[model samples]
Target: MTDDARELADDVQELAEAQRQHWQNTYTTHPGMYGEKPSSPAVHAALVFRAAGAKDVLELGAGHGRDSLYFAREGFTAQATDFRPVGLKQLRRAAQEQGVAARLSTVVHDVRDPLSLPDASVDAAFAHMLLCMALSTKDVQALAAEVRRVLRPGGTLVYTVRHTGDAHYGAGTAHGDDIYEHGGFAVHFFPRHLVDSLADGWTLNQVHAFEEGDLPRRLWGVTQSLPQ
Candidate 1:
C-alpha cells in the first residue's frame, strides 16, 4: 500500500481506539443510563426464544444484566458478555442479589472480536443495541459471523440497531459508512440495505421497527437464525 494509505489506516485505528475508551467511560460515568428494566425488544425476543424452546442463551453487550437476569428468571441459563468491566461488575452483584447467580454468568468481551465460546454451544444469542456502537460495517459482519458460529442449529439470534430513520442519524459528525460521533460517543446507523447485507448468510426472520426515548430513537429489531 502507498504511504498515504497506510497513514490513513493508522489514523482510523487510533480513532477506533479512542472510540472504545469513550464507550468505557460512558458506562463508568453513567452507570444507570439504561436502568434495570429489560428493553422492550429484549422482552419480545425472550418471548420468541421461549416459544421456540430455547434454554441456553448467550447475550452480547449485556449492559448491567437487565436482559440477562430476565432470561435467568425465566428459567434459561444465560451467559452475558460485555466489553465494559464496570458494567459486568454491576451485573455480577445484581445476579447475586437476585439469587440467580447460578443461572447467570458475566464475561468481558469485545463484540468487534471473535466471540470466546465453543461453536454451536448456545440455543440463542441476543444483543439489544450492540450493532450501532461505532462499529464499522466490517465489524458488524464479524460480530454476526461469530454469533452464527456459536449458535446451535435452529438457534435464534436477535439484535437491535439504530436505523437510518433515527432522528440523530445524520446529525452527528460523520465517521464513515453511516457512522457518526455525538456527545463523546460514536454510532453506526444502519440503513435497510446494510441490514440486509449483514444478514446475508442467515435466514432473516423479522425486522420490526420501534421507537425509544423522548427524541424517539428509531430502531430495527431483527431476528435471524442459522439454517437447521
Candidate 2:
C-alpha cells in the first residue's frame, strides 16, 4: 500500500481499538446504562418482524441486550451481538433474570468483521444506532452485505442511524469518511445517498426520521427486505 493508504489504515485500526476500550470501560462503569427498556426502534421492529411472520431475530450492536431481551419476551428467539464483552455479560445476566435465557443468546462481535453466521439463517435483523458508529463508508456497506447474506430470502432488516442532520454531525475531531469523535465516542453520520446506495439490491421498505436520547439524536429508521 502507498504511504498515505497505510497511514489511513493505521488510523482506522487505532480508532476502532480505542472505541472498543471506551465502550468496555463505559459499560463496566455504568452497567445497564441504557436501562432495561427497549428502544422505540426495537419496539417498532418487533411489530414489523411479527407482521412478516419472523420467528428468529438477529440483533447487531445489542448493548446490554435491552432490545434482545424484549424480543425474547415477545416470543421471538433472539441472538444478540456486540463488540464489547462487558455489555454482553450484563445482557446474559439480564436474560437469565428475565427468564428469557432459553430463548436468548449472546455473541461478542465487531461489525467491522464478517458476521460468523450461516447464510439465510435468520428471519429478521435489528440494529439501532449501530451502523452510525466509527465505521468507514466501506465498512458500513460490507456490514450491510453481511447482514443480507445471513438473512433468509424475504427476511427483513430494521436498522437506525444518526444522519448528517444531527446536532453533533460536524462537532469534535473529524476522522474523515463522515466520522467524527465526540467525547471519546466516534460516529459515522450517514448521508442520504449512502443509505439509498446500501439498499440497491434489496427492497427498500421505509425510511422514517426520528429522534432519541436526551440529546435527541436525529436518526432514520430504515427497513429493507430481501427478494423472496
Candidate 3:
C-alpha cells in the first residue's frame, strides 16, 4: 500500500479504538443501558434453542446478559461473556432476581483477546447485534473465530447483525469509514460481503435479511452448523 493509504488506515484505527473505549466507559457508568428486560431478538433466539434441543449455550458479547436471562428462564444452561465488569454485575443481580441462578453463568471476556474455552465445549453459540461495531476487519474476523472455537462440532451459530444498507447510517453512525465515532466511541459497519467473509471456515446453512415496521433497522443473520 502507498504511504498515503497507510496513513489513512492508521487514522481510522485510532478512531475506532477511541470509540471502543467510549462504550466501555458508558457501560461502566450505566449498566442499565441493556434495558430492564431483554429484547425480542433475545427471546426469539432462546425459543429457537429450546426447540433445537440445545441445552448448553454460550453467548458472546452478552451485554447485561439479557438473552442469557431469557435462556435461563427457559431452562437452558446458558453461559454468557462480556468485557465490561459493570454489565456482568448487573446481569448477575438480574439473574438472581429473576430466579435463573441455576441456569446461568457470567464470565468477563474480551473476544478480541485470546479465548479460554476448550474446543467443542458448547452445544450452541449466539451472537445478537454483536457483529457490527467491530473496530477493524481483524476484530470482526476474531469475533467469528472465537465463536467457532467455543462451539461443539455440529453446533449451531445463531447470529443477528445490522445490515449495512439500512437507513440508519450517518444519523448516529459513521458512514464511508471502516469505523465511526458514536456516542463518544467508534463503531465498525460490515457490508454483507464482509459478514460472509468472516464466516470463511464455517458451513453457511442459511442467510436471512429482515426488517420490522419502520424501525429503519435491518438484521442480517446466518445460521451455521459447525463442521465435524
Best by TM-score: 2
Local distance difference test values of all predictions, in order: 0.85, 0.94, 0.73
What does candidate 3's lDDT look like per residue over 71-186, in tens digits? 88878899988877677888899989988887899899866676778987888888787766644576677767877887887778887776666655455655335555455544
lDDT of 2 at 115: 94
Candidate 1 C-alpha lDDT tens digits along 1-228: 999656645654666789767767887889867888888988998898997789998999897879998899889999999888888898899899989999998889888779889999999999987888777777788888888889998999999999888888888687667877777767788999988987787899999998989988899999988788
| Cα lDDT for residue 1, candidate 3 | 91
lDDT by residue (43-102, candidate 2, tens digit) is 999999999999999999999889999999999999999999999999999888889999
Could you tell which candidate, 1 or 3, scores higher by lDDT? 1
Task: State TM-scores per candidate.
Answer: 0.93, 0.97, 0.83
Candidate 1, residue 75: Cα displacement in angstroms equals 1.1
**C-alpha lDDT (0 to 100) for residue 68 of candidate 1:** 94
Candidate 1 deviation (Cα RMSD): 1.8
Clashes of each: 0, 0, 2
Residue pairs with backbone atoms closer than 3 Å in model 3 (clashes):
19-185, 19-186
**Candidate 3 stretches greater than 4 Å from native:** 1-17, 170-177, 212-215
TM-score (C-alpha, index-matched) for candidate 2: 0.97
